[model samples]
Target: MDAKTLERLLNQIAAEHLHIDTLATRNSDRLDFHEVSVWGLKEALQAAFTAGQQSKQTTQPN
Candidate 1:
């Protein structure tokens, strides 16, 4: 797929993940609280994704 396609798909997925994470944290129970932090995971994943996008954006056209 093209960069534009991938970016659009990733943006949608990332937005969904963020929304879910916000909801999860807003009403977290003791059981879910001890589990992995959704924000941390979301942040890490977003950081990596952003880096990849930046790299792609900065690449010289062949």
Candidate 2:
């Protein structure tokens, strides 16, 4: 993806992360069953962003 598109995706992910964090905080005590799922989703999003950045770096000319 181009820089603009990648940036947009990252922004969207960040927004979603914030939303999820808020939800998790609000339901922290009751979300034990879903804690793992939520954590995994956050990690996956972060990994995706990191991979995108790494790929962009590798493909760009220094």
Candidate number of the best TM-score: 2
RMSD of 2: 7.4
- Residues 1-62 of candidate 2: C-alpha lDDT, one tens digit per residue: 78876666655654455333322245445542333466657765786778788888998999
Q: Lowest lDDT 10-mer window, candidate 2? A: 18-27
Clashes of each: 0, 0
Q: What is the lDDT of candidate 2?
A: 0.60
Total backbone collisions, model 2: 0
User: Which has the greatest lDDT?
Assistant: 2
Residue lDDT tens for model 1, 1-62? 47786666655554455433332244547523534467756774886588677778878585
- CA displacement after TM-score superposition, residue 3 of candidate 1 (Å): 21
What is the lDDT for 58 in model 2?
90
- Pairs in steric clash, model 1: none
Flag clash pairs in model 2.
none
**Local distance difference test, candidate 1:** 0.58
The whole-model lDDT of each prediction reads 0.58, 0.60
